[model samples]
Structure formats: structure tokens, C-alpha cells
Target: MRVPTLQTSRQTLDAISTRQAEQARLQNRIASGLRVQSPGDDPAAAAQAELARSRLAHIAQDQRATQLAASVLTTADGALAQGTDLLQAARETLVAAGNGGYNLVDRQALALQLRNTREQLLKLANSGDGAGGYVFGGQGSPVAPLTGTMTPTYDPAAGTQRVGENADYEATVDGEAVFMNIPQGNGVFATSSAPANTGTGWIGAGSVVDAARLTGHDYAVTIGGTAAAPTYTVTDTTAGTAVASNVTFSDGAVIEIDGQRVQIHGKPAPGDSFGLAPAGRQSVFATLDQAIALLEGNPTNAAYNQGLERVHASLDRALDGVVLARAHVGEALRGVDAGSASNQQETLSVTTRRSGLEDLDLAEAISQLQNSQVATEAALRTYASTARKSLFDLLG
Candidate 1:
């Protein structure tokens, strides 16, 4: 139905106002490079964009956390590397001191060198991250982990800090796991031939087959009987209990006891004996102390050989422990790097999606702005013309 004269002017004015408002909205979009000026523009898209933004923020936070974890691991890795070097040097010194040509004075000189190395190892053990936190601090502690002027003491507990998302490289390497509680004696079990053995029997390095069944015990393998009817017995020296008795001994036999297994690889005469002890953890500080003690002790004493053996064993385990620790650090670093790459990809994907929903398309926005301007001008001209015609008609 056609409107009355007064209503016609009002309708024209409303149409013009609507055109002007649309033109202003388009212009704003074009100038600001944004599609949604307010939630009303596209409520669903606006909500999606907000979620995308929150995801981006979370990604940024995860990136920062990953970086911090990497830094801490890097520091620990460097210190462990240094520790390995020091252990190697000490090993070389021990080997040199073992030479028959070396005199007491020479041994004493080596001792002094090892004392300095001990101090250096201590420093590495008690290393700080310069953030008022220690690299080996388990959980966290204000005091140093290793303290004391001579024979630095170790704190059994240390912190294990993890980084990253819920899955993948998020669990970080722990300090105590690396440096403090490393297994001694081949990192599994201690194997040795009897000190009183007159035969050429030997025991090879053994491994724990069943982790659950492994009972840390001191076991002695005593060989008796004739070569034809060789017999062996397993006795727990620590508990003073017998494990097995009168088992036939073979040239190469795999002995299993208390969930631990070992192989004897050489010929053994009657009265020969072999032993196995549970592997325990030791600190790098203790290894250095033993080395120093060997040099200070009487070289010709009856227990001199045993002491030397102990020191060599300790040093070897220390070196192995550091190497293992470094391996873990490297692994953690790789995890962080991988996590970083993943985060970057996710950020890119979210940003792209957000841009599609909220960012203006420059070409389309400009085109629409131009069309709106044209339409607004046309509406204004039509309104003015109709208003003038209505006045002329009324006058006539």
C-alpha cells in the first residue's frame, strides 16, 4: 500500500539513515582491517575468534616454559660434560700411579693433583644456574647439595623439573637421577673373583635380567670337589645364609640367584671362588675421595691392591654415570626442541583460522566500502528529490 504524504517523508528519511549506517560500517572495516567491529557483527565468529586468541596465549606461555626448561637442561648438560672430563683425567692419573716405576713422591704428587680435581668436581656437583637455584637441587633447596671442605657431602634428594605440554617431551630430566643415585659396579651388579683364589678362574660383567627379582645381596660362589665332579655353593656373606649348596659347576655356567644372574667364563680349580654383590649408588665426590686416599696410603700395605681396585671401580662407575646423565640431558633438550616446533605449527594454524574469522579482506572490504558510499549518496538524492516534489504538490 502507498504511504500518506507525511509517512512517505519519514520512510525516506529512515532509508537514508540505514544507508548511511551501512556505509559507515563498511568504511570502518576497510580502514581498520577488521571484519567484526562488535560481537553483533558476527556473534558465532566472534566467539570462535576469542577462543582462538586464548589458544594463542596458551601456546605463548608453553613456549616460554619450554625455553626455561631447555636452559636448565643445557646448564646441567655442560656441568655433566665437565664432570666426565674430570673423571677421565682422574682415571688417567690412577693408571699412571699404578706404574711400578713411580715412587712415593710421584704418587704424592698425583694425590695433590687429584685433590684439586676433587675440588673441581665438587664445584660442578654444587653448580648453580645463577638464578639463585642449583642445577642439581631436587625440588628446591636454599643450601648447596654438596658441602664441606674435604670430602664434600651429598644430599640424597634432588629436584626433577619437567617442561612442555601434557604429552611428548614434557617430563624433564631430574638432577638426582643423573648425578646422585647412579648404580655402581657396572651399573648393575658387582662381580669379582675370590682374593684367595689360586686358580685362573674369572667372572665376567653381569646384568640384572629381572628388575623386580633383583635382591641387593652379597653372594659368594665357592668351588670345591674334583675337576671331574666340580661343585659350587652360593652363600650370602652379608646375611650369613646359604642360597644353594653342592650344585655341579661347569666351565662356563650361568648362575642365577636372588633374581640376578652372572656368567663365569674361565677355568676354575678346586678351592677357587667368585663373588657377586648388589650394585649401589655413589656420588662423584666419593670417587675422588677414594682416589686421593689411595695415593696417601702406604703403597706396600696388604690392602693396597684392594684399595686400588676399589678406586678404579669407583672412577669407572662415576664416568659411566656422567655419560648416562649427559645422555638424558641431550634427550630432554631434543624433546624441548620438538615441543617448540610443534607449538610453532599450532600457533600458525590457530592464527590462520582466527584471521579468517576476524581479519578483513582488504580487496573485498574496499570494494564494499565503495559500493556503500554510492548507495548512501543515491538514497540521499532520492530522499531530497521526493521531499521537494511533495512540497511542490502540496503548494499546487
Candidate 2:
């Protein structure tokens, strides 16, 4: 009889303890608002929730990436804008330098102004990301990739920073393309007057008339007749061959050679020559620097005019490069915005999925908790009443 009583008591106590544990679990679920606290709670649901959480984390990371890219790109865009304005100011100074009414002193003042512009432009080119990194630092850049000297130097990286590997979403513009890799002279070739010439002739910026006919070789134009009836000859200095000889020289005449066309203005003395060569990369800084040097030498009226024209063409191209860069940055900002929107949407979807997997229903949990509490109280009362009863009374 005693052994049977001990077994009965142990069984009742186990039942009561189980009910209490269940009530406590319900209370915890209500307070914490999560149904699956551990994998053991609901293994499948917990696993799925973990996956959703991981996806959400990735979405968050992507959002951060796009945000960072937008910031860097905005900085680059603003710098390029300022750069454009500085280049415009420099162009205006070049125009002023060309003024015949402006004496050497006046042009020198313009040169000083141009020097400041060049410095400002250089500063813009090397603009930072506000975190000790270059905003225009393509793939990689040193602390200061571009030198700050009057003759700025740099070998800009090839590719820009980006938010994704295959994405066209660039975080920064290619500094090389914007500031260094600009076409010199015309897009095809450059022209220059011979330094030793005693003529008042100026070489205009040439253009490509026939791409197929261009030899991509250097050529020299030599004037060889009396001033009254001047004649010209074209020699391929690169190939040491005469392309044209004894061509009639006319003032402000177009001299087309091997597919390149340039105009000559003003009188030319015999032996006055001009040079033409394939276009190469001319940095905006170099262009400005050369323009600054234009007035340093007491050049002839013709030489000053020639230098002025060349500088103007380069400045035009420089301005175009900056505008194009700014446009590119704008496109990148739009891309970032699109990416950000997509990321936010994904985050919302994932959050919903994760919540469904692990989140508790407050109303259901509260009702379950109340029922559990009642059941636990009844179990304790029953166990206490049974414990007080004697074995002999139960047997009777």
C-alpha cells in the first residue's frame, strides 16, 4: 500500500510540474513576442527564419553600398561642376590675353589669373571622398594621385570604384578620362607654327577631312617663294617624302595634307613653316599651363594669335570632358537610386517572411498564457488536496 502511494504521489507531482513549465513558457512567449526562440522550439521554422534574416542582412549591406556610392558620386559630380566653371574662367582669361588692346602687362595679369584657375582645377581633380580617399580615384589611387605642381602629373587608374562587380554603377568617375586622357589639337591631329619663322602667319586648329587619307605621320609646310607670289610645299617629315610642292600660298588659305586641313592667316616669309602630327593625350592642366606661358615670351602678333587659337580649342575640349563627366555622375546617381529602391523592397519582403516564421501572435499568445495559468493553478490545488489525504482513507 505504501509503495503504491509513493508512485501515485510521484506521478501527480510530475503532472503538476509539467503544467507549471508549460505556463511559464507561455508567459515568456507573450513577453518576448517570439514563438521560436531556439531551433529546438520549432526546428523547421527556425531554420527558415534564419535564412530570411540572412537575406535581410544582405539587403541591408547592399543598401549601404548604394548609399556610399551615391555619396562618392555626388562629391565627384560637384567637383566636376566646379572644375567646369574654373575651366570657363580660364577660357575667358585666354580670350582676354588675345586682346590686341591689352598690353604685355595686361596679359601678364591674365596669366596670373589663369595660374589660380589651374590650381583650383587641380584641387578639384584630386577631390577626396571625405574619408581620406580620392573621389575620382578610379580603381585605386594614392593619397594624392595628381601632383599639385604648376605642371601637375598623374597616371590615373583605369577603372572607377563601384558598388558591384558587373554593375555599371560607378561610385566615382575615371580621373584619367576627365582630366588627363583628352584629345590634343583636333581630335585627329595638332598643328603648330615653326618657332624660327619671321612671318606673321598663325596656324589654325586643323580638322580631319578624310580619315582614310590620314597617314598618322608628321608633316611640315614650307613657304618657298617671294612674298608677292608665295608658294608652299608639304613634306612628310616622318617618311622624308614630299607630299606636295610649289602649292600656291594664299593668306587665310586652307592647307590640306594627307587628310588633315589647317588654315593659315597673315603674311608668311620664305622658310616660314608649320608642323602637323597625330593627336595625342593632352591633359587639361598642361593646356592651362601652356596658355599661361603664352604671354611670357614677347611673341610676334602672329605667334600670340596662333598660341591663343590652339589654347582655345583645348579649353573647349576640356570643358566638354568635364560636362561629360558630370553627366556620367548623374547617371550613376540615378542607378544608385534604383538600386536603393530595389534593396528597400527586398528588405521589406524578407522582414515579412522572417516575422511570419519567428514572430508571436500577441492575442493568441495572451489567451494561451491565461489558459495555461488556470490549468497550472488547478493542477497545484489538486496535488495539494491529494497530498493531504491519508492512504488509509483512499483505501476505505
Candidate 3:
């Protein structure tokens, strides 16, 4: 075979260029501390590195979510703790009021304290969870979980005041389990009966029951025993005429004057009357309304005292709600921690796998670089020697 002189020189130069390029690339990798600087260098390695980087980013994002969740839970826990203290204080006031030595004046003083404690509790219930939402309001935003005004009515036949929970977080806990599981009040007022009325004639009526009083009325009203023959005595005070007749109440039941509502189970006072359906969902306020009425009225009465006892029991029930809520918070915290740990582990594993697929072996890279350096040097030396010896020297 005839060898072309120019072709030999061209091939030597090409080989030297390729070796020098490889050496330069290895030096760049070392300087940058990264295996794959460009896709052109190693397309497969670059793709693998991108995948690892994406996984790391997701892991970091999940960690932030976990931290945020922890903060929310901590805030919720603190609010619940404050609520528990307020409830305890309210119970102490109730017990003090129960003491025989407390006169009506003393009872009135106790009522003031009760009102203060209740206000504190309302603040706690409406506490923000540090995330622009009420901790107790489930998913609702920017509104308090518990809210309403309270008014005093001198109705004798009412029940004691009690606090109840409303809007509970349902995402991590059962709403009913946390807010609707309050214990039944004393047997004095059957869950199905209208509370006994006080001997004092109805003091007066209002245009609108205050929000709190109305809420209490909602829980206080109940259906009593089997319906009796309905009847009505209409004394026309203005007309000065007494008329007696049988007034048929629905379901053969007459409304009793229990002071809560004018439902079929009970009749409103001369001036009092039932209004439209409740403004909001039934809640602790409703329960408390019934309880406060029961407590203030003749405490000496058995039914009244029974209602009071029930109110105390309700305190325990409310506490149970807090405990249940805390349990859910705890569970959520555990889940968040577990998820963060899982993400961390996965990130580490992916990083290792990606390193294996994309990262250069420093020893191998260093050795290859040295070899390329040597080959380029050899090529340079050969080129210089061949260029010096011309075609005449070759022929000789």
C-alpha cells in the first residue's frame, strides 16, 4: 500500500487535537467539581443529574411543608391549653355559686365572674392558628369559630348555662367526635322534655333574643312526654273577656311554657314567641344557654340543681373534646414527621444513585487525563521531528 505523506501528518494532527480536547475537558470537570458540565460532554450523565436535582428540590419543598404543619399544630395545642384553663376556672365559679352561703348578690357576683371566664373562653375558641384561620373553624377562613351576643332573661323555667364546641377540624379529626359528643344533661330535664319553669311570672320578652341567648335556647328546648289533649285559655286582657276552648296542637301536643321556644313541645310566654330556624348550626353556645338558665334559677330546686350538675358534666365533655383534638394534632405531627423523613431518605438514595450514574471517578478521570496529556506530547514531538526531515531525507 502506498502511504500519502500529507495524510500521515493530517492524521497525527487530528489525534493530537482529540487528546488535547479530552485533557482540557477533564481539567474543567476538576475545576468545577461537577462530573457533567454540558450535555454534549455526556448526554446520559447530564439527564441523570437533572433527575437527581429535581428530586432534591421536591424533598426540600416537602420539608418546608412539614415545618409549616408543625407550626400550625403547635399553635392549636397552645390555644386548647388556654381553653382548658378557662373551663377549669368556670367550673370553680360554678362550685362557689353552689355553696349555700352565697346569697342572690353573691350569685350575681359569681355570674359576673362566669361572664368574664366565658369571654376568655370565646377568645380562646376564636384564636387564630397562625395560618389565617380559626383553629376550631375547620376549613373556614377569617371568621371566628364561636361568636354571638348574650342577653339575660329572667325566665324562671330555664336551664343552666354551658359551653359547647362548634366547627371542629374535620381534615384530621371527626367534627362530630370533637364537638357533638357532649354528655347528656341531668335527668331533671329529660333530653326529651321542657325544663321546669320558675315560680316567678315571666319577667318580660325581647324584640330579638341576643345571639348568645338564642344559641342557648336552641339547645334548651326539647320534646317532652307523650302528647296530651291540647287546650288553650285565652284571657283577653285588653278585651276583658275570658274564653276557654280546645286548641289543637300539632301531633296532639300543646306547646309548653318552658321559656326556650314556642315549638310543639312548649309554648312561648304571653309576649314571647318562637322565631325562624336557628341562624347558625347548633353548638356549645346552645348547650351553654340552657345551662346558664338552669343554674341561675332556684338552685334549691332538684331539677335546677340537676341541670347545674349537667353543666358541670358538660365541662368534662368539653375537655374531652380538647383532648380528642390534641390527639388529632399529634397524629398529624407524626404523619408530617414521617413524610419528611421519607423524603429525606428518598433524596439521599436518589442522590447516591445519580452520583453513580453521572459523577466521574476522580481516580479514573485523573489517569485518563494524564494519558491524554502524554499522547498529545508524543504527537507534538513526532510532528516536529517529521516536519524537520523533508521529502528528500525520506527518499535518501
Using lDDT, give the best candidate's number: 2
- TM per candidate: 0.77, 0.86, 0.64
Best-to-worst order by lDDT is 2, 1, 3
TM-score of 3: 0.64
Candidate 1 per-residue lDDT, tens place, 1-396, comes to 222487777887888788788878877887788898789999999999999999999899899878877777788888988988888999998888778777778888999999988888778877887777778776666778766766555563554655555534433245566555656656778777767776656665566778897677789989888877888889998889999999988866888878787766555778888888877777666666767877887744324444565567767877877798789779878888888899999999999999999999998877877887888788788777665564447666
Q: Rank the candidates by TM-score, best first.
A: 2, 1, 3
lDDT of 2 by residue, 185-205 (tens): 766788989889988888899
TM value for model 2: 0.86
Off by over 4 Å in 3: 1-4, 37-50, 151-183, 186-282, 287-300, 391-396
* Candidate 2, superposed: residue stretches over 4 Å from native: 1-13, 155-158, 163-172, 210-213, 235-245, 377-396
**TM-score computed on alpha carbons, candidate 1:** 0.77
lDDT of 1 at 56: 97
| Overall lDDT per candidate, in order of appearance | 0.76, 0.84, 0.53
Give, for candidate 1, the lowest lDDT window spanning 10 residues: 165-174
lDDT (10s digit) by residue, model 3, range 1-396: 223488888988888888888888899887766687788878988887888888788677666666666666677677767766777777787777667676767767776676676666656656665666555554443455444556211111111111112112122222233443454432112232223542211211112323334322232222222234333433323334443233443431433322222223233222221222222322344455555665555653434444455566555556666676777667766766677677778878988988876677888788888888888898899888876785567787
